[model samples]
Target chain A: MVSNIEWTTKEREVAQEIFDRAYERETGALVEEIRDKASLIAKLEDVWQLHDYLSAKRHNIDGKYDFRDAYLVFVFSQLVKEGWVELNELEDLSQDKLKKISALTRM
Target chain B: MVSNIEWTTKEREVAQEIFDRAYERETGALVEEIRDKASLIAKLEDVWQLHDYLSAKRHNIDGKYDFRDAYLVFVFSQLVKEGWVELNELEDLSQDKLKKISALTRM
Candidate 1:
């Protein structure tokens, strides 16, 4: 297991701010309109999920950007700029798929 | 603001199991190798960030996938199946972009 690097309180706060602002700018609405702050913070935590996987993969490389940081700076920023899809829609989609899969299993 | 639909405890547990198994199957290693459970849970929270945005966009569409669910089922599943790009590499790429942007700003 690669050693985990926890995001400092300051880092988390900053990242959250960036995420919120970008999200608002692109969608033209505040994040709180649909979800609460606690919920948003919870989701932001996933940014670190892939950190260990990436760190191990890039262990041999020099001067790498921290996985968590890169996700915020690049992938996420792009997602915000492009506008993100909604959670309810995604859940509905999942239900649909689950039903289809269930039907197939019963057949 | 669209009505928020929170994931139930059961839903969260089920989603995590699916995410973890899919991740391990594709990476040939468990997620715990690099990050802890708490961290992984945090990241998964983000699947909901775009929900409001997507619902508003697709509000008129009949029989559409929820953004969050679609992300898990389609986008995330594809990422796992395709062998996700290492987070570090994405970070490195981001750093390169940042450096270039910084340089341009300074010029």
Candidate 2:
């Protein structure tokens, strides 16, 4: 809902400058164009945090970081709500659980 | 909250197969090694949706997809909750907002 079609010249200029830098730096080339600063900032943070979170979780062996992390709770809830994971027989999964879900989703 | 520490061999074997594929395909190399099937499934779904969501958002131009998408509302709320984006002065920001936030975070 946030749009930047009404930005003042100074604001728009600054925003354009940033976009140019993104194109030059390729930091967020995929999400460079945005309607407003709020949404753009929001998307940037989402990518930034997601990249960090994924990198950290990818290495966790105990499942303590991704499974129990506060930030991922919403994502976990979404999956359980979607029936991707069993609710009634909730037991701690072994290291091999991922393979099953991947097959299911890939199918 | 879900864990699979008590899975039977049949169940664990099935799960292991799925993990092997992920390792083989590199679909989710970052968030592997969960303790249970349920948790692993949940984590995998998180990464899956997040990857889809980010790739889509990263390419959005008008900020329509990333800002207004229902899934990102939680993320947006998180940013606002964390005070990374201004709440009281909620206005549509230009692209420059990203550079500002990036500079702030990079510090």
Candidate 3:
């Protein structure tokens, strides 16, 4: 399933770099800070804003890192690693299948 | 900062339940499916859609779980666990501060 995506080698490299940068931080402190609901929401809002920004930005360089894509992969990889979403449900499904599933889930 | 938000105990409980349900799934499969750029973007789009749904839904019961908030916290927790965002920068910041930071990061 990992190989099915369209990430160029450069994009993967960029994602790796972003991943590494994130890894260097003390996540435990952040976890500790988010003990209450308000902080958690604030952080989520921040992430959402970032996601929106990345989604809107255009990349001009061919085979270059799309920061938005790289960031999503970075975050989504963590979601998988931390068990937030079901992998089996997502795997084996084609993009069309995923879209159908997404449509069904929409309110 | 965690305590600054408004999540009730019931909301926390709901988030935990959702977290547990997600944990029971095989996330590795989902991760494998998102290997390329298109698949990754698709998965992200799905997540964003879900996030939007949760954000829009309202909970009438007092102290009951707000699925949207619960889900955000669940996902945000994973983001912290996986080192995607810097905790220190977030921990001491007030919501206004965070908003400012978010604004700065926005394109």
Candidate 4:
């Protein structure tokens, strides 16, 4: 049976590094220039907030978890709307298919 | 004796409402138009992340907590640099002084 997760520990590290660098770049006087400010932040917040919520529920691994699953789906949907990431052109995604997409990122 | 925390449950509720409304308004196509996007999100992330961190450490209350404390101080420093909030003009603040400013927001 396939797992629901797709993102590996490696991808999480890369995302975290990219995210951290992005965060450092944004914190200073240059903050006004980043793109899709509110929505991006809100989406970032969604992921981070969910991480927070889940961590409290004891479901996270040191603030990072598998992303190619439900969380990644949620993130992909959010990013797609903002033009940060793309959605598949051929079909509208169902929850089940989204789940399958998530399975692509697992370890 | 004065407590270090100044934000009341009332303030937290108001802040939460403002924050939630702000959040809802930003989550869609309009996300790109928001100001100081990265810095604001980073700051928002800081607050929410702190809330998450603290809550996981068991210090948060229903996702909101007192803001006129260390967390608020940290947030204020972040915002002031972005021109979202102001720092006291006459005085160069010491950490102790910052703590006093925080005391002003307590219930």
What does DockQ give for each predicted structure? Answer: 0.01, 0.01, 0.02, 0.09
Per-residue lDDT of B1-107 in model 4, one digit per residue for the tens? 23454555655555455434433433432223222322344443443443354345333222333354446544444334433334453134454545554454341
Q: Candidate 1: TM-score?
A: 0.18
Candidate 2 falls in which docking quality class? incorrect
Q: Can you tell me which runs of candidate 3 are displaced by over 4 Å?
A: A1-3, A26-75, A79-107, B1-107
Global lDDT of each candidate: 0.35, 0.34, 0.38, 0.41
lDDT of 2 by residue, A16-86 (tens): 44334333332222222211211323333444455454445444312322322232323223344444333
Residue by residue across A52-101, what tens digits does model 1's lDDT show? 32233234221222236333333332343345422222232234332332
lDDT of 1 by residue, B16-97 (tens): 5555554445333322222233223233233242333223323422122223632333333244334542222223223433
Candidate No. with top DockQ: 4
Q: Give per-residue lDDT, candidate 1, residue A33.
A: 24
Task: Give me candidate 3's TM-score against the actual structure.
Answer: 0.17
List chain B TM-scores, each candidate. Answer: 0.28, 0.23, 0.26, 0.28
Q: Best candidate per lDDT, number?
A: 4
